[model samples]
Target chain A: MDNEVLNTEPQPTEEVRVVMPLVDILDGDDGVTIYFEVPGANSKTVDIEVKNRIMTISAASSLRRDGLPVVFKRNFRLSDGADIENITAKTQDGVLTLNIPKSERAKVHKIQVQ
Target chain B: MNMLARIRNAEELLPSTLGGLHELFRSMLDQVTDLGPEWLPEGSAAGRALTVETSEKEVTVKLPLPGCESKNIDVEVIGDQLTIHAARTEVKDENDKRHYIRRERSFMDYQESVLLPVKVRGHEAKASYVDGILTVTLPRENPGSPDSHVVKVD
Candidate 1:
């Protein structure tokens, strides 16, 4: 039973590499926002990367002082309407939010009648 | 036929677009080592997994509550049971009209209770939420007692 409990711990070990962070993707008139749940991550330890319409969020959890570190990773596919060059991201209280703005041509706008 | 040889042969037959043998092995490993629902902590019935650590004088409980603010959380202890309740509210900006492309996060209500493993002074328990993790520390009712007593769970 002791071994069973130890083996079932949620903390990740050194060999754990592939982790899927829970996420939420939201869209608005101007842009989109994505939220990732990484329980122990802070601004200093999280990394965001985007290339060829693929966005990946990678983070390391360091909350347990005496426990092994846990890592989190999640990927997203950007739509053609998204403006990749103007994307912005922020991390607060273990939640990472990404704001991906839509391209000027894709955003809805009214054209005045001539 | 050797199992390794057969696996390699099967890998060659699979499309290269699917990441070939490397992706296949990684997925197999993930399936074999996946921690199912059974791995959830002893006391939680419907919430996420919780971590419990015991020391000489106190027992500490840690739970993840991402995006949950302290204002919406409540912790209570009753007899040998400890319960956590929280309601999460999504924060939105006033300027923008929002639409959801794929929404996985929103308002969520959580309530979970756990039976204490050892005798504890429930009245003296203290809890705090920090960096999205709720930590509860409960002191032993009779520390240094000759035998540890397990409290009955209702």
Candidate 2:
């Protein structure tokens, strides 16, 4: 394929009808920043977890769609360089910004001239 | 063997784009997707989602404008049409220019008009923006009629 798909879909489970919130990922020298659009989600209802090198984001919103409860859920596989322990996240204006620091090995190293 | 005309043996798997065929495909795809009708394609431009609810006395419309300032949003109700226009701006300093590797939440501007389900008193519309949801409620011009009435057969 000429264009590779960086995004992914959720696993089919009991909650197959979940609302998969869209996301955008940015790579920086120090870390990776991910923004998720989850309207009506607050800090208390949003949950972020990492297990087995997989990051799972799940949130419940007071907003209802089609008279049913709205649940935002998605998963992303983390690279080895992701410093999961030092990850941080913040929710503002219905958007969740997650920052995962890059490990020492993942940082770019320049060779010095002798 | 000489043939006057060429023939193919495969069935028409996909419908043609002419006429209503394309609309049929779009409706089918819309049904498969669980998202609301107001929501546009993912990661695209400033497409927004708005929900409309109507009752016997009034009609309410709600739009989720995340990360947007209330001052930037304008709601107008004219006749039986409701129009909303808003913008989500990016804060940038002239001295510091931050480069983004991937940006899905860039500065966006949106404007859309929707027809109200019932005649509304546009002048009596009340709008409030809170928690990124802009809600507008308008009193019905004629509240005497209910949405539906159960009639008994003799």
Looking at candidate 1, what is the lDDT of residue A25? Answer: 61
Q: In model 1, where do residues sit more than 4 Å from their true spots?
A: A1-14, A63-68, B1-47, B92-96, B144-154
What is the clash tally of candidate 2? Answer: 0
Candidate 2 lDDT at B7 equals 11
- Candidate 2, B55: how far from true, in Å? 1.3
Off by over 4 Å in 2: A1-8, A11-17, B1-48, B91-107, B147-154
Docking class of 2: incorrect
TM-score of 1: 0.68
Question: Could you tell me the lDDT of residue A4 within candidate 2?
Answer: 14
Candidate 1, B12-103: lDDT as tens digits: 66677765555545332211111212222321221235777777788788887878888889989888788999888765657657744445
Could you report the DockQ of all the candidates, in the order they appear?
Answer: 0.20, 0.15
How would the docking of model 1 be graded?
Answer: incorrect
User: Which of the numbered candidates is closest to the native, going by highest DockQ?
Assistant: 1
Error of 2 at B5 (Å): 46
lDDT of 1: 0.63
